[model samples]
Target: MASVLGPLQPIVDMVTSPLFLQIVLFPGLTSIAIIGALLGWLERKLTARVQLRVGPLYASPAGGILQMFADLIKLAFKELFVPENSDAFFFIMAPTTGLVLGAALVGLIPFAPGLQIANIEVGLPAFLAIITLSPTLILLAGWSANSKFPFIGGLRALFQQTAYEIPLWLSALGVIMMAGTLNLAQIVAAQSTGWFIIPQALGAFIFLVTSVAEMERLPFDLPEAESEIMMGWQAEYTGVLFLAAQGPGFVKLYAFSALFSVMYLGGFLGPGFLPPLFWMLLKTLIIIVLIMLLRSTFPRVRLDQLLRAGWTTLLTLAILNIGITYLLVVGLPTL
Candidate 1:
């Protein structure tokens, strides 16, 4: 019996290891992939409901819940297709890098008290910095395709991301002011007295609008507008290349929604009945649903309208929110 137990000790140790569980399972590469796939299904099912249709009923016995997993398997075996004269290296690398960046965004978020894989002191800044890299990659993919439409699509993405990011950063600055720390976990703890959404409502609104733009969804999805440029910068990708190109959109949605939960919805703070992880996830899903609803509800805006709103309207509102937050932060002691 002792000899038999000894042989399995290494297996037991490896399974129980903290790094393995966190990095490979929850809030890591594998989890990111799974969640991104499920979220794709969720979007379709939800959009179908909006149009008075039943969604995803065939892939599995229960409402086609396994449809996305099945799709993932199919995509894994799909062939890679590159354009005639395209630079295959960067064309392939761009979307893969987007997937990695999406996973990296989750690492900075604290799901529960002890759940963060990496707890950087300047977590907020770190997340903002990493997300900014996504647009450049989009441009890279479009240019590497060596086609006019894709290059044009990539340029649109570059312009869109550049226009909106200023407002996004400004809106987040309000949170940094009120919380008085860039650490994400500490921000959650600071909300013990009250949530930031109450005082920072304007900032949250600006953040949501800008975030949708950053994710390139719905009204802001000019880069991949099917009718206009035939999937835009994503035109040349097929099979697994297409999956790699598109998977990060869902992954980024999850990451951004989780960030929204942490900053505006109080991270993992909730009533004691349910566990902390449950509450955190609940908030993140709610945010995800809200964003998805926006995708279904809004008409696609022209690029000019999008840039105008981002630069003028959202930017103004963000600055105003910052001013209000400054007053709140300084006046709290007096009150």
Candidate 2:
């Protein structure tokens, strides 16, 4: 019997390896979650500073480092509110689906050579596909709440998704054209000569803009327009459920920043003195800070303006970027 199964032993061992389980699933999920939480704190603190007010100072005076934790605890203890008319089942399930799907994407993202949880050949497509589902889940959550605010929020989110998805994918196509690979690991490796940002600057800018829209952060947070809709789709959620929903929102931001770092900024390609993981983390942090700064500085654009920018401005720019990249590929001297 042992001899009969010998041929499959390596496969089985690979599946059951402690290293794979730890490094891939556990660490990846934990790290992203922690980063996401910290980012939430940073966004609040920085935005407050920009607005000339203190942010979460009672939680931790230095910089409100524990603000997110305090918020999390408060959320955990709050009452779970469910409208009598709402579909309780889907209301409960929507946030869970969004959180899981977003977190799972981290597995397919490679931080550096030999450091990824999974190295799928079609990583970029897989990521795009997974990310596109998040808005649908948010829509579901909003509709399930059976409230006017949430329903409106869901509709806004759907429209925002429709508006931005095209340019987002088009911009990614530019990167794919330049890198000549959809696999993120190969994409990062191609940057060994130089980061793609230098040549693909337009594509990077398109991506950054679309990614911010995707994140639904300030200036693009029309879906959750507090002044207009009052917390939008998450109005009814309370306790841990609300926290869970917020968790995935931040995770999406972190994952996108990580992907941007890998695709354009040279993932983990620092000097020999630093480890690959350190370099990757540093790059991701910088991107996140930039995002935070943008959130602090900009006012939310009107919905009509957002639509016009996405359709006219970003789409045109992305198309031009692709054409330029193609020209450079054909015209540049061979190495």
lDDT tens per residue, model 2, 126-146: 998999998898899999998
Task: Output the number of the TM-score-best candidate.
Answer: 1
Tens-place lDDT per residue, model 1, 47-157, is 999989999999988888888888878887888778889999999999989888988999888999989889999999999999999989999999999998899999999
Q: Where is the poorest 10-residue window by lDDT in model 2?
A: 18-27
Report, for every candidate in turn, its global Cα lDDT versus the true structure: 0.91, 0.86
Over 4 Å off, model 2: 1-27, 60-62, 332-335
> Roughly what TM-score does model 1 have, to 2 decimal places?
0.94
User: Candidate 2 at residue 291, lDDT?
Assistant: 87
User: How does residue 18 of candidate 2 score in lDDT?
Assistant: 60
What RMSD, rounded to one decimal, does every model reach? Answer: 2.5, 4.1
